[model samples]
Target: MDDIYIILVASLFSISCGLLGSFLILRRMAMVGDAISHAVLPGIVIAFLISGSRDSFEMIIGAALLGLITSFLIEFFHKKANLQTDAAIGVTFTWLFALGIILISVFAGQVDLDQECVLYGEIAYVPLDLWITDAGLNMGPKALYVSAFILAAVIIFLSFGYRYLHITTFDSAFAASIGISIGLWHYLLMGMVSMTTVAAFDSVGAILVVALFVVPAATSYLLTRKLKSMLLMTVLLSFLNSFLGYYLASTINGSISGAIASTSGVFFLLAFLFSPIDGIWIKAIKRNFDKSKNTSKTKFNKIFKE
Candidate 1:
């Protein structure tokens, strides 16, 4: 069914982004995903110009390369130029994004890329974009295959590099002292993020990709402290976001991507207010209960003294 296909693709993309996003959040480089998403625009344009086609594979290859360069520039500025990390990210993404706009303007006739499609995406159209065999067999939506492949790749990357990523993320100084190449792992992580971002473009677009990258992970962070638990929760939340978002969009006749993104935010708000670990409402209730208990104890002491 088209509904199933759309939700499946969204869930896969959300899980991939959330898996990588967990680490990015811990590393305080969550915005790097945002940077790469925007910075890859020029790559898409360039790929279109050279290939003279809007093939997904060519666009991904080009965008992935630009994403890597964006990562490098951010790191280079932060480390070598001694700029703050935020500053580095700001400088690199804006410059590249502006350049992409310039290129689009200059070659308006050649490039068929629409800014709205790039930013907002059209997940509702996934079922229509089927991959057909040469013999005329329908292999389902191409977005489904791409999302599944990316999700598998992300799982493999995290499984193998968990130790290095965990150590480097939480204790960079200790990791460096132990001779673990933090920079190498950092770039590798960034590379994976780049690939995932590019792959999700057709399914969710850049804006929703960034939301999926950061929201589920962040929401899980509030629910748990253990890295493994957080990851599991993130995956669960990703699925919930996708399913709920789809139904919500159908009910309202709205954009699926926008609805999914809004659903992620709603979930995040719930976690922020209700998470047992450190939720604001829970903390407030605990504080008031403690105050009441202390007051009762003081009263009892006064009565006993009297």
Candidate 2:
């Protein structure tokens, strides 16, 4: 496919991932995104075995179902077995991913994938081998189109269900008491995360998928406290990083996914150091300013009293 189109699609995919990820971070379930991304390998492998190829629809369906299962397992262990949340996530994801790794190693000769491909996908090549139509005109790549629709779906869902999602993310118990099905919302959010991960795999690959999931949203969180604003900021940051990363990779003759991930890291670094609301530097500055203002107010009050 064309390089330009590939870049566009890749950026759109990142944007979609960032949208859902904003909520994940707000809900303090950021680690679950990481776990789901890793645990998806087994599902993809199983889907391939059943379908006998890397079919997009089938793979996504199978992968998303398995991702939900992984989340369910983590929840089960945490609630029922009383394990630490982190421990539950670690044990479950690692076990599943390890099984997938072993399966790949054993079936290396027969399988259509490789470790390198899984970790860092060829985003630059997605537009090259796209399905064409009778007109001979270049239709967009499937990954790009699929990601766009999914992103739109997520944005629409968040828009209409803003009230419910906001309440649930901030306080699930309260949301439930108020008539929201916290259970449905939780599953829906995680399901979207899984779907994004699977769609992103073909663009940035599996290991780096979390970059799309976490970094841009995190950077946005550092910049905004409001949910809708944060989601918008996340998408903007994600797309900017994607554009910069893709261009930089062209310059250095490097991997696109690595470039995008590194770009995201840079975004997080900037947000951490300079964001006006939650950044370390900004927080300190605000504190000092507040103290100076208070001192001034105290002197003025004493003068008035005198």
Candidate 3:
């Protein structure tokens, strides 16, 4: 039963990350997910310090706020300081992440978080944190509920704002020409990323959360060009990772989060190898076939001329 709950929780996190990650990948901002996930560490630490309690609401609010700040800082560095986008992201996230480590070490006795857990996560312990009602009703894991809510929010926002998201993603100038506020939509998207990252950070940690966000979406993108197909494929792949990773971890007595991340990477490798349109090996084979055909046509032409 505990294993089942853990898988369910992981599934929710995977689905939520996949849905939002599709947009991030399309916008060529896939690394922003990585940036935000790591940058939120300081926010989590600060929230813990202020509240002195690990309440979900406080943690989420703090992380989400910092996610927005991280986005703003990245933009500021890129535009104001003339730094490259990647450099800006690297600078901002590294600073916050370092700060978070310092805070954790300083408050080692008070805080329960560990550097190791932030890096890889202890998802096996997720099942232990059950959410019980005052009536003594078993309400499953709190992580499950939080992840499910974030998943629903992502679906609803994407469903309604599909046009805006699609336009802004492929053509920000066009979106602006049509009177869309690109900045507004961008920050809104970042907010979603922040909340999703914070929610999954507990179960998967900062490093692995980036995998869940980017890998499935990236694999799906390689497999298909259409947005709808990519989104559907991403969700399906997330579920596959969650279930298969859980079983694999159980069989090997390894880290569940690590196994799940590995599963996502495996799917990505398969897609990269076999995708019909853009796969590296497929392109190589096609080029070889074309060369052979051309060579045969040249030989036939010479023979006919002779």
Candidate 4:
């Protein structure tokens, strides 16, 4: 069904983004996904110009290259130019994003692209973009296949490079001391993020891609301390966001991508307030209980002395 296809594509995209996002959250580079998402606009335009087609593969290659460059520029600014990380990210993304807009405006007649559509995608259209075979067989939505491939690639990357990524993420100093190339792994991670962003761009748009990248991972991070547990929880939460968001959109007659993003935010708010590990409400309750216990102990001591 169309509903099932749309939800499936959303879930796959969420899982892929959430998995890589765990590492980004750990490294304090969560916004890097946001940067890459916007900064890749020029790459998409260039790819279109060069390939003379809006093919996904060319768009991905172009965007992935730009994403890597964005990562490098951010790091270069932070480490070499002594800019704060946030400032560096702000400068880099804005500059590149502006360039993309310029390119689109300059080639307005030839590009045949809409920046608004690219930034805020329409996920409900997934079922219509069917991947039909040459022989007239319906293989299903092309977005589904793209999302699945990205998820599979992310899983493979994490599985083999877990040790390096884990070490580099938590302790770059120790990893460097042990001869691990932090820069190499960082770029590789960014490359994957870029690919995921580009692949999901058509289906969910840049805005929702950033949500999928950060929200589920952040929610899981609050719920669990272990990286492995956080990743597993993120996958589960991604599915929940997709399913709930679909139904919510249908009920309200709203945009599916917006509903999914809103659902992710809701879940994140719940985790922020109620997570057992370090939730705001839970910590407040613990503090109050501790105070009461101390007060009771002091009262008992005074009575005993009397």
What is each predicted model's overall lDDT from 0 to 1? Answer: 0.91, 0.86, 0.91, 0.91
List ranges where model 4 is wrong by over 4 Å.
298-306
Better of 1 and 2 by TM-score: 1
lDDT of each residue in 1-306, candidate 1, tens digit only: 999999999999999999999999999888998999889889888988998875466877898789989999987899899999999999999999889888988999998867787888888989998899999999999889989999999999999999999999999999999999998898889878888887887677777889999999999999999999999999999999999999999999999989999999999999999999889999999999999999999999999977
Give candidate 3 regions above 4 Å deviation: 297-306
Candidate 1 accuracy as lDDT: 0.91
* lDDT at 276, model 1: 98
**Over the stretch 1-306, how does candidate 4's per-residue lDDT look in tens digits?**
999999999999999999999999899888888999989989989998988876467888999999999999998999999999999999999999899889999999889677876777888989988889999999998888888998999999999999999999998999999999998999999999998988887778777889999999999999999999999999999999999999999999998988998999999999999999879999999999999999999999999977
Model 2 stretches astray by more than 4 angstroms: 134-138, 292-306
* TM-score for each of the candidates: 0.92, 0.91, 0.95, 0.95
**Which residue segments of model 1 deviate by more than 4 Å?**
52-57, 294-306
Best by lDDT: 4
- lDDT tens string, model 3, 1-306? 998888888988999999999999888888888999999998998888887866468888999999999999999999999999999999999999999999999988888789888998888888788889999998888777888899999999999999999999999899899999999999999999998888888789999999999999999999998999999999999999999999999999999999999999998998899889778899999999999999999999999977
* Clash totals, every prediction: 0, 2, 0, 0
The residue-by-residue lDDT of candidate 2 on 93-195, one tens digit each, is: 9999898888888877767878787878888877765657789876767666777877887788788878888899888889988889998889888888888
In TM-score terms, candidate 3 sits at 0.95
Question: Total backbone clashes of model 3?
Answer: 0
Q: Give the worst 10-residue stretch by lDDT in candidate 3.
A: 49-58
Better of 1 and 4 by TM-score: 4
Q: What residue pairs clash in candidate 4, if any at all?
A: none
